[model samples]
Target: MADIIIIGGGIIGLSSAYYLSKQGHQITVIDKGDLTDNCSFGNAGMIVPSHFVPLAAPGMIRQGIRWMFDSKSPFYVKPSLGGGLPAWGLTFLKKSTQRHVEESALPLRDLSLLSKQLFQDLAKEPDFDFELRNNGILAFYKTEKAAEEEAHLAKRAIELGLDMAVLSKAECEALQPKLKLDVLGAVHYRCDAHLYPVKLMQALIKYLEQKGVKIVRNQEVTRMTTNGSQISSVFTGTKEWKADQYILATGSWSPAVAKLLGLNISLMPGKGYSFMEDEPQQRMSIPALLCEARVAITPMNGQIRYGGTMEIAKINSQVNMNRVEGIVASVPKYFPDLTPAVPALKDIWYGFRPSSPDGLPYIGRSPKLNNLVVATGHGMMGLSLGPATGLLVSQLVSGQRPEIDIQAFLPQR
Candidate 1:
């Protein structure tokens, strides 16, 4: 069995450990913080095969620039003259083309569908049960402008062989007769699914432990000691850990870790926030995206979670109350029956999504190192893409071909 050390204990790291351990590899996971809190918690727990388009597609530059001024807008970018963001900006602009989006769609669709199936299989395992639902996701739009855009995207999705339906206002109301929606129309992706993220994380971690994977929390990798073509060992916060193969699954901090080994990856942290209501005044039967506001609403574990706002900024958790309020403000406009009470800054949960310049994940072995693999930069789709990434890492380690073509997700690209 190979000795593998996985850096970062987020969903990607833990999932990698699970798959590797299952294949009889002696696994060790190192994390910078205690495993109690992580990027996996408090996220909109949806498995979306419907999201085939990359975030850096055409017209995003205009929208991101437009939203740059509006604090309440769904997307924003904090200007930074340093930290290689300018270079990333240029690359992002170049990748925001029809060619990029078309090239990205099929691979992304394959990955999400595979991960969704893996999640289903994971649910059937003993003690791994959580709130797994096939209730699907509704992308509801209130504005005619947004509705037209969604309709175009839905047409593209249908052409791409995705299972979806374009529902009029009355059809939408028919599906959700309980709650009143203030939307012109909705695009229903029937292949999507949702689950309780916290439960999934807990179950996966527990299963890994039971299967002899060593998980060491609060141990951060500070540096790497490498040979000519392979990483010999990694220096962490308290000690140096060596392994035959290493997987760098650190979420938002992937680029920083890659730089330690002289690897170039264009990654930025996109901060997002969410507030949970103990008992939703208006509980949604299915998860829905307020398309105009980019706010995500999910019914999970006796509570409803409203999450939105992609703030591309530096690495910190200083809560922007305006952004949180913006999410709360958009809810009532979309779902009239649900007037949510805003929570204090302390009560809200926020985390950084590892965003790539082209909105595609980095998943493969580092070109410079023989035994190092990079499995990060998933952005908003990290939760949806975790298991497939793990399975791919395991396949790479075992010298077996991956099920999906991974050329699009090569770390160097």
Candidate 2:
């Protein structure tokens, strides 16, 4: 078996290590932070096959422009020309076409389904128990415009062989009998599932350690040495680690990491925020996605995690209270009894999602470096797509055929 070194300790990196070690490969996962929290932990924790629509879909540019004016908007791009934002924006504009959306649906659906199945399989293992629930998610809409859009999307999902149904407000109430819904209608995405992300991350770390995988924390990759067209070794200040193969699974930091090797990858860090609250009553059974608000509410670890907003900009440590307020404000408008207060700054959690211009993830082998594989650029779907990407990464490293055709997720695309 080959010795593999994976950079980034988030869900994608750890998942890659998990699968690689399972195949008898010597794996070492290195991260800049302790393996405690990340985008993988503080997310909505929904495994959604229902989310086939890419972020760069039609009408997004028009909507994004309007949202730019509001500090509390669900989507905001901090005005800046630096950090390659202008080029990424232009490519995003170019890809926000109906043809792109139509072309992306099948591949996104197939990838999500594969990941969902893999999660189910993992949950059955004795060492893994992350509260994997297959009850599906509810997309609640409060306005007529949102209702019509959701209906159209549901119809398209059904056409793609995904299980979805349009439900009236009464039908929605039937699903969550304990809580009162103040919405016009909802789309029941029965193909989706939910899990506790923190537990999931912890379980993977524990299981990998038991199986003899080395997880190195607080080690940031500084440089890489190349022999011909292949990567020979990676440096993280104190250590020079050599491996037969290297995988770049860093999330939002991928662009900077790729730049170390003189490669240009068009990606931006889309920062998002989330906070959890005690839900002793457990009023919410199925996870809810507010259609117009773009907020996600899910019950995880006996608490409710309210998360939303996609702030595309450079990575920083500032907490935008307005965005968190927007998430809190939208919850009551949908579920009247489920009003969450704006969390304190200390209670808030934020993570940067590595987003690509075309909205699909960057997977598969790098064209310039034969020994390097790229697996970042998952955006909001990073947690949802983790296992499938990891499995595919292992397959690529082993010189075996991937389970699905990954042409749509090529890194150099």
Candidate 3:
């Protein structure tokens, strides 16, 4: 059996460890933090098979430029010439064509469908009881423009063999009878699902530890020693750890870790914010995505978690209150009564999504290092796509064929 070392303790790393250990491989997971703080948590907890479209799609540049002027806009890219942003921006512009979107649809759909099935399977496991709900998500639109956009997307989804239906305001209200909606119309993506991310991550860590996987928390990889093309050892301060194979699943910090191994990947940290509030009434059973505002509100863990905004900037600790306010302001527009107050700074949680320029994740073997697997750049869908990525990583490590064609997710592409 190969001894494998996985860097990063988020959903991807832990999921990889879970599958790799199931194959009877000796596994070790090392994380820079105590595992509680990562992008895997503080997310919208959406398992979206409906999201086949990548971020780098047509008309995004026009919309992004419009949003740039508004402080409370859902998407923002901080101006910077340093640290790969310029080149990433150029590639993003190049890939934002209709041809790119058309080409990316099938692979993304397949990956999402695979991950949704895997999530269903994982929920059935004895050790897991994370609130895995398959109630689907509602994409609510308030404007005619947004309604047209969603209708077009729903049509594409239906053509690709996905279950989606366009709903009127009355139909949307019937589905969500407990709350009032001011939307013009909505699209019910029957293919999507949701879960509590904290519970999922906790269950994975607990199960892996019980199965004898070494989890070294609060240990950051400071340096690496490589022998030719293979990684000889990894160092965290004075201690050294070695394994037969290595997996780099670090989320937003992947580029920095790859740099240590003389590899460069085009990735930017798209920071997002989330805050939870008590919803004892459980008024919203189905998760709702505000079409124009780009906010996501989901009923999870006896509370409603409101999350949104994509700030493409350097990773930092300061919380942008304007972004959080943007999420809060959008909620009342859709659900007139569901007004959530601006959460205090301490309660607000922000995490960076490792976004690729082409709006697709990088999940494949490194061409430069035979023993290494690169699995990051999942962007906002990291949690939704975690299990599929982990399963593919296991298959890649075992020299078996991947379940899906990973040509679109090549790291060097």
Candidate 4:
């Protein structure tokens, strides 16, 4: 069995370690943070097969441009004179075509379905308990135009074989009795599932430790030394570590690491914010998306999680109060009876989504580095697609045929 060193202790890295360890491979995971908080911890926690439409879809460029100036908008891209952000933005604009969206749908749907199944399998394992729920997801819209738009997507989803149903406002109210919505209609994707992200991460980490996976936290990967096409060793300040294979799952910071091997991976950090309510007045049995607001609400474990907002900025951990307020403002719009309480800003969690230009993750070996496999650039779908990404990564590492077509996700293709 090959000894593997996995970078970043996020869901992707952890999941990869889990599968690799099961294959009897010795695994080591490294991360810069405490591994308790990150994007993987604060996501909407929805295993969304309905989200087949990638972020780089048609009309997003126009929407992005319109929302660029609004700090409280659902999406915002900070204007930067620096070449890195601009270059990525241009490529993102270029990829926001109908063809890219059409091509991305199948792979995303397959991976999401695969991940949902894998999560189900993991849930049945004795040591793995993370409040997995398959109650489906509701995407509610306030205006008829919005509902019509979603209905169009729902029809397309049906064409792709996803279990989707469009519902009127009354029908939505029937399903979610507690939510006092001002919605015109809703689209329910029965194929989606939800979980408590933090709980899931904690359980995974514990299970990995029990299975003898070495987790080194607070140690950042500084440099990589290579011999021809293979990585010889990785440096992290005080130590030089060698492994038969390496997996890069560093999320937003992946591009910097890739640069060490002379690979140009355009990854922008899309910062998102979330805050959990203490005993929310209203509860949702199924997770729901406020379509116009672009906010996601999920009833996780015992608390209510409200999360949304995409700010394309440099990788900084600073929490913007305006963005947090934007998410808070959206709560009342969806659930009309819910009062806006002062969210604990200090307790609010924020993490950067590792967004790629084409909205598809890079999940294969870099052509420049033979032993190194790239698995970041998942953006918002990282948690939803983690298990499938891990399974595919393991297949690549093990010299087995991949279960899904990875042409769109191939690095340097």
Q: Highest lDDT, which number?
A: 3
**Over the stretch 70-145, how does candidate 4's per-residue lDDT look in tens digits?**
7788898888977379788888888888898898899898888999999999999986889999889999888888
TM-score per candidate, chains pooled = 0.98, 0.99, 0.99, 0.98
Error of 2 at 8 (Å): 0.8
- Candidate 1 vs 2: which has more lDDT: 2
Q: Estimate, for each residue in 1-413, the C-alpha lDDT of model 2 and write its tens digit.
A: 99999999999999999899889999999898998988898999999899899999999988999999988999998879899899999999999999999999999999999999999999999979899999999999989999999999999999999999999989988888998988998999999999999999999999999999999999899998888899988899968999999999999999899998888889999999999999999889999999999999999999999999999999999999999999999888888898788888999999999999999999999999999999999999999999999999999999999989999999877
User: Which pairs clash inside model 1?
Assistant: none
RMSD of each: 1.1, 0.7, 0.7, 1.2
lDDT, each prediction: 0.90, 0.93, 0.94, 0.89
Pick by TM-score: 1 or 2, better one: 2
> Candidate 3's residue-wise lDDT over 1-413, tens digit each?
99999999999999899899999999999999999979998999999989888999989999999999999999999999988899999999999999999999999999999999999999999979989998999999989999999999999999999999999999988887889988898999999999999999999999999999999999999998889889999999999999999999999999899999999999999999999999988899999999999999999999999999999988899899999999999899999889899999999999999999999999999999989999999999999999999999999999999999999999988
Q: After superposition, which runs of candidate 2 have C-alpha atoms over 4 Å from their true positions?
A: none
* Global CA lDDT computed for model 4: 0.89
**Candidate 2 local lDDT, residue 344:** 89
Q: What tens digits encode model 1's per-residue C-alpha lDDT throughout 51-116?
A: 999988999998888888887888988889977689888889999999999999999999999999
